[model samples]
Target: MRPLRIAVCVKPVPDPKESNRLQIDPATKTLVRKGIPLVINPLDRHALEAGIKLKEEAEGKVTVFSMAPPAAEQTLTETLAMGADEAVLLSDLRFAGGDTLATARVLAAGLKKMGEWDLIICGAESFDGGTAQVGPQLAVLLGIPWLTRVCQLKREDDNHLLVTVEDETEQRDLLAQLPLLITVDSAVNQPRRLSLLGILAARKRKVITFTADDLPVDLAGIGLNGSPTQTRDLFTHESTKKVELLTGSPQQVAIQLLDKLGLTEKGAGQ
Candidate 1:
């Protein structure tokens, strides 16, 4: 039987701890990425780890693809240090101000250029956007069956795969036929640290960079003009929880809180 060919889609995002502030262009209504420090999207790290584990088990090649501003090359390098065989970066000014739909269009085009693969993997969502729509939406464009929130995977056969995942309200164990797409849940696995050797190799690795013109993408469906969704307003919220004090012993305090919420009986909160 042939070995499995895996492709993992990754993204670069700003570090969450630093700042969630938007640098917007006043005239253009576009988010400015210039001079922004980029990090690998948190969820994507799990997806990459899942791909590496699968490669170790199945003896296959694992390729990673990312779309972002030109500075996002750092993200590709980081993934290589984590054990991806090769990396591809799609960076283009034409791809700026894109929403999820525009992102899927360019990514699907890049996948075509990267050669045929048996399985494609992605994070359930990007931490920066957290839209959680790109993977499944890309599958729709690629005409393939896609599964999300996959927490576990095992080989059922040469051409079959078993997956355990969580749905909106329940957990499901499913047997998926091969040549399908999957989005890994962040809680599925822990991503490994980069080995010294891998880091050294990453320093010398060549990440293939492509622009919008490099692929057969519909120019109309790739950037700001193609995105249907628009951000109308944005702001931050102040905490509104009121603090209360109870003059009582530990158990008495608990009882008082329960009484306040009318939860004197079991399952009252529910």
Candidate 2:
């Protein structure tokens, strides 16, 4: 049997621990990411773990793909240390400020250029955007079947798979064929840590980079210009707290509270 081919999609998001330091740009209505250290989106780590586990069991290779700035090369390199055979980065100034749909378009084009694959895995959503749109959008663009919120997977055969997915109401098992895409939930698996040997091995390998010109993408369909949704307003919410002490007996204080809340009449009616 031919070895299975797997592709894992990942994103570099700002560390959640540093969320306090994150700022929103008034002009773009986007998070200001300058100087913040980037790490793999928490849920994306589960997706990568799924792909690596599949590759190990099915005797195949795993490649990690990302659409990010040049600085994200370090994030992709970390995937290499996690057991991906290779990594590809799609980075270009023209690809900046892209929304989920625009991102999927570029990813579909890049994946088409890379080669054929039996499976493609992604996180259910990005931590920063939390849109949960890219994976399904990529599936639509690629013209493939896809499943989201996947919690378990088993290889039934070279061409067939058994998948388990969970939603708010129920968990169900599904049978799917190859050339499929799936977005895994964080509950799917625990991500493995990097080892010294894996890190050293990753240093010897290079992350392949592709610019806007390298892929077959319509310029009009990428970046901020291609995004259909625009944020009209962005601001930080100001929260205020007020404390008052009512001086009286318990009964008087209770009545005062109801009056203050404008519920005295309603309480009396009841």
Q: Which has the greatest lDDT?
A: 2
Question: Per-residue alpha-carbon lDDT of model 1 for 1-270, expressed as tens digits?
Answer: 457899999998877665656566666655566666778888889999988888888789889998787888878988999999899999999998788999999899999888887889999998767889999988888888999999988777888889998987988999999889999997789989879998987776678999988997999998889998877754445689998889788877887878897887852443
Give me the candidate number with maximum TM-score.
Answer: 2
In order, what lDDT does every prediction score?
A: 0.86, 0.91
- Candidate 1: residue pairs that collide: none
Candidate 1 scores a C-alpha RMSD against the true structure in Å of 4.5
Candidate 1 Cα misplacement greater than 4 A, ranges = 20-36, 244-270
Cα displacement (Å) at residue 201, model 1: 2.8
Instruction: Tell me the TM-score of each prediction against the true structure.
Output: 0.85, 0.89
